[model samples]
Target: MSDVPPIWYEFRDAVYCGEFQVAEKMLRETPSLLHMANGIGETALHFLAVEDDQRGVDWLRTKGFNIDTKNEFGTPVLFEVAQLGYKELCAWFIENGADLTAQDRDGRDIGEYLLYYDKSEMADWVRKLGA
Candidate 1:
């Protein structure tokens, strides 16, 4: 069996725990770790969505990470951020060309999910973007 790199696990854990500083250090030391996924197929962006860190999101976006990458569940980064009512992150995703119409594994569109979560304002904003 091939030995798994310890830094990869550390990077994934740091992202999950919102330790952007540590994650960044790990990325700088081992750029290949940036592509590593968690058990749920979640990348650093997915963890950022869970942590709701706008700064971290902005930093990752600046690093040219794929904004629309889907997790194992088929949920896009923007969808997760939107579901959490992260207006700024959602707006950033929109500005950066995230696929607003992308759906999750459950067939729920981002706008539909926003409406379901009682975030009609965000849903309306998404609708306006498409118009």
Candidate 2:
């Protein structure tokens, strides 16, 4: 049996399926949902990252969701996007001031994670940002 709530699945599904309006309505109706984490401590932002939903991420940011919010493993949304090689979304996060030096629980930086995940292009892009 999963420790995650049923509504969490619904919410994650809504975001993953690109049903932004449904996600928005759900969030508005249950504001606490934003703070709710699933079994892995991943919030809706993690789902948005997985789907590469930059606009949805921006919307959530405006709703006061922390860009640096970490999951149980201490991986922030930016770090997740970086390793996934979502250049555009990662760039958007960078432009919007996502923490560049954020480390996971193991103290591995985003660049290292990117490189380890074979996202050298993303690693280069991130390096250029700091240059």
Candidate 3:
């Protein structure tokens, strides 16, 4: 929010548009962009998760970014994407070290959200994982 760099917007636009190659090129030139958060502390990982780009997520993780990076509200990238009902992604996150028990400032964990949004199967799955 504070005078974000023009390239950051370009980078975000590329990612949002599903142009991972272009986004990767931009990041290659501006490596710090990987860790740069927006006004609310959301990073490129958040966008990639929303896009369901597992490869992109893995790429970011290989670059040393925490997959559990939280936004200002304490919502992790995995939690944000769980609402979309991507069961495979949910499984991958849990298998790859995502914290299923992570909660937001509202005291809501992934299971609470999955159940709230009628994702009973996902809720049940995460519940089994100790969410």
- Top candidate when judged by TM-score against the true structure: 2
- Total clashes in model 1, counting residue pairs 3 or more apart in sequence or in different chains: 0
In candidate 3, stretches whose alpha carbon ends up further than 4 angstroms from where it belongs are 12-29
TM-score, prediction 3: 0.77
lDDT of each: 0.74, 0.80, 0.77
Q: Please provide, for model 3 over 1-131, each residue's C-alpha lDDT reduced to its tens digit, 9 standing for 90 to 100.
A: 47667787787777667687898788889999978877778787776777787776766777667888888777778777778877677677888899876887778888887777788887787778666
lDDT of 2 by residue, 20-68 (tens): 7898898888888788888889787776776798877777778777777
Q: Pick the candidate with the highest lDDT.
A: 2
In candidate 2 the C-alpha lDDT for residue 39 amounts to 86
Clash number for model 3?
A: 0
Judge candidate 2 at residue 89 and give its lDDT.
88
Better of 1 and 3 by lDDT: 3
Please, what is the TM-score per model? 0.73, 0.83, 0.77
Error of 2 at 41 (Å): 1.6
lDDT of 2 at 104: 83
Clashing pairs in 1: none
Residue 59 miss distance in model 3 (angstroms): 0.7
